[model samples]
Target: MTLASSSKPSANRKPTSYESLMAGVAAGAIEGAITYPTEFVKTRAQFSADAGGKRGVMSILTDTIKTRGISGLYSGSGAMIAGNGLKAGVRFLTYDSIKELLRDSNGKMTPGRTVLAGLAAGVVEATIAVTPSETIKTKLIQDASSLQPQYTNMVNGTIGICRTEGVMGIYRGLWPTIMKQGANSAVRFTSYAWIQGLMINFTQPPSGKLSSTMTFGAGAMAGLITVYTTMPLDNIKTRMQSTGASLKYRNSLDCLTKIIREEGVQRLWGGTTPRLARLMMSGGIVFAVYERLIGVMTSL
Candidate 1:
């Protein structure tokens, strides 16, 4: 049970690409399922054009349940449950691959260099997986005007977008998604690395093992920072992807402008609480499971 460190690549065994990918996928699936209700709330809040101001998380939750039924709390979760594995797998696999190349003579990446790697990984994942998944999820959640629904499920939602808007439609928020993912990963990885380094130095366990609590704490803090810093971009991405032809934002910038003009600047921070809560838990679970699984699988 050794604490994996930047300076100790050999001392701390690493997982293979396949192993890391699988570990990430497994971890993401678990986290996504667990935190999906909060995510549903977050998306709904983001899409709410005239929230007046920051609404309470519970109020949003209760309203959603009352209007859309309890099932509404899980609207578009199919995409989340389906794509989160690929999203997280790509994120970890790409991050590790890039970080491996960036490690210095001591097999260590400085916090700054680690942030670069995280940024790269986030960009790659967003381009390959996140944009499409989010597009479908948002469409299903926010585009449905009536009880009939625009998308009955993920598959049809994806098909409908493709049929109507072509391939480009499914990637409507690609730029914002990349920016958000890059910034999110940069902050998350940098903070986690700094905190984990401190934890390793302070504990210095006899067996060189850092406990799960340490990993979870580091990840939670990192997630909180990411959520706070990237909420505006997240809001923009959601609005752009979900609005479709109705609002017809030209791009992320346009989306931001329209939201501010029509809804006020405060609209950009909608759903902060649920998003923070979900990501905090998700970050802890994702990193802890990823690290633990890496240790277990590599040993085997």
Candidate 2:
């Protein structure tokens, strides 16, 4: 529900909490799977200097089909489906839950601190549940020529990593993932909450229910902000993760400087095409599903 709607909760038009949460998770999972092709291509372009870091999205897509074929485009689809879905689910839950707590404590939500609440939610999801999957996701997108010992199965390769390294091994790239996502979350959750506030203001409710369109719009706006703000870190984070944990620049800061010196400043934005598309589509789907799921659940 939009913040405006929440301010004046009523018995008749209440939105269902369960429906909202489920909708987002399901949408994020499905969209994450379908968009895996784009994400894989994006990952390859960002990480593989051999792939010609400057290749256009079209070229990358075609190259993927010609060389690895369709299945290759979704090499890490399984992990993404699970990871992204969980990320979306937890992020939403945390965001709303925190907002509720804050409101209860302070009387009402102030838009000025919307980003703070969002940062709280993002940190929780990224650190606890999403980090491992994200690290694996990066490895899965590397070029076959560049595939490392741990990334052989791409996204599914983490199964072996877990067997060998235990739970900790899966998080080899956890720091960078945390760094990237923490910053990304600041942008995403803030924008989402702020936009939701705007929507509520524009469409003040007779009760507490927001139209489905408002939820989608808020999600998309929040997504756009997050993707653009942190896409550079995201690119570097993916590259570092794909590299063998033993090899590579040692840590996130090192990975940052190396990419800048070697690939030039523009390299940070590599694979932005798919990343943008991924966020826009997935963001809208996630929010819509999240809100609707809760709505339906409440209805039942």
Candidate 3:
């Protein structure tokens, strides 16, 4: 984790953040629709200290039924749609573009440098593209519990904040989201460097450079690593975004320490099962798509 800062100067190239953003938006839309219900449950599980003992694995499902009904699960889905779509697209494109700038004069990319490049790109990507969306989504998801009582869903949440907290109200819990996403991006990008090499060895590309499939395999492996490493930060982030967020965990570090004390270390990985599934699937899909985009770029 003691790697060099991405702030090291590099050549300027026009960033296609918008294109990548559109792609991610498409992907994010699909992803959010498929995953939000589960995300809803995951958020609940992470923050529901009051519910006690999870109410069991089926608790969220049952509770969604008991309380807000079916659509309850999709309460904050709009923010997820906007945030995840842009975040996924922008993060990938920025990371790739940064790595290319830092490639060796030999045209070969070093894994270490690649990692640093990804980290740099991640910091920017998370800040510019994902933070606000994250802010909104977190607020909406937590609104389900009625704890904050201010934010309930997208429309009301936006209006509520505009009324009380002003334009700034939309940016709740931004600091922790930054920490979590920045770390998540660093791990994912760094892992991809090593994982891609391993895949190249295992897959053995046809004569002309590493095949797209090999690169994708590497991405899949890197994705698996990211989910496990970042799950705890995610758990805390979810809780911070929960309905009754006044529980007082403070920042990500503070919330983390409290979770360990109250729920044990294992509680940090609250919804890893579905999360891993989503991570791998989304990572693989996005990486493969990104590879294809690069192929088109190279050809042109």
Which has the higher TM-score value, candidate number 1 or candidate number 2?
1
What tens-digit string does per-residue lDDT give for candidate 3 at 1-300?
011122222232323555555555566566667767766676666656424555444777787878778988788788777777777777766765676688688655666776676667667766776666666766666666664456556878768755766775555556666767877788877776556555555655443234556555666677789999889778776666543454575666787787888778888888776677667766665666554554444344
lDDT of 2 by residue, 216-272 (tens): 777777788888799877876676666464476677788788878887888888878
Higher-lDDT candidate of 1 and 2: 1
Ranking by lDDT: 1, 2, 3
Q: Which pairs of residues clash in candidate 3, taking residues 3 or more apart in a chain or in different chains?
A: 142-242, 142-243
> How many pairs of residues collide in model 1?
0
* Top lDDT hit: 1
Cα lDDT for residue 287, candidate 1: 89
Q: What lDDT does each candidate get?
A: 0.80, 0.69, 0.65
Poorly placed runs, candidate 1 (over 4 Å): 1-12, 50-56, 67-69, 144-147, 245-247
Ranking by TM-score: 1, 2, 3
Per-model TM-score versus the true fold:
0.91, 0.84, 0.78
> RMSD, model 1, all Cα superposed?
2.4
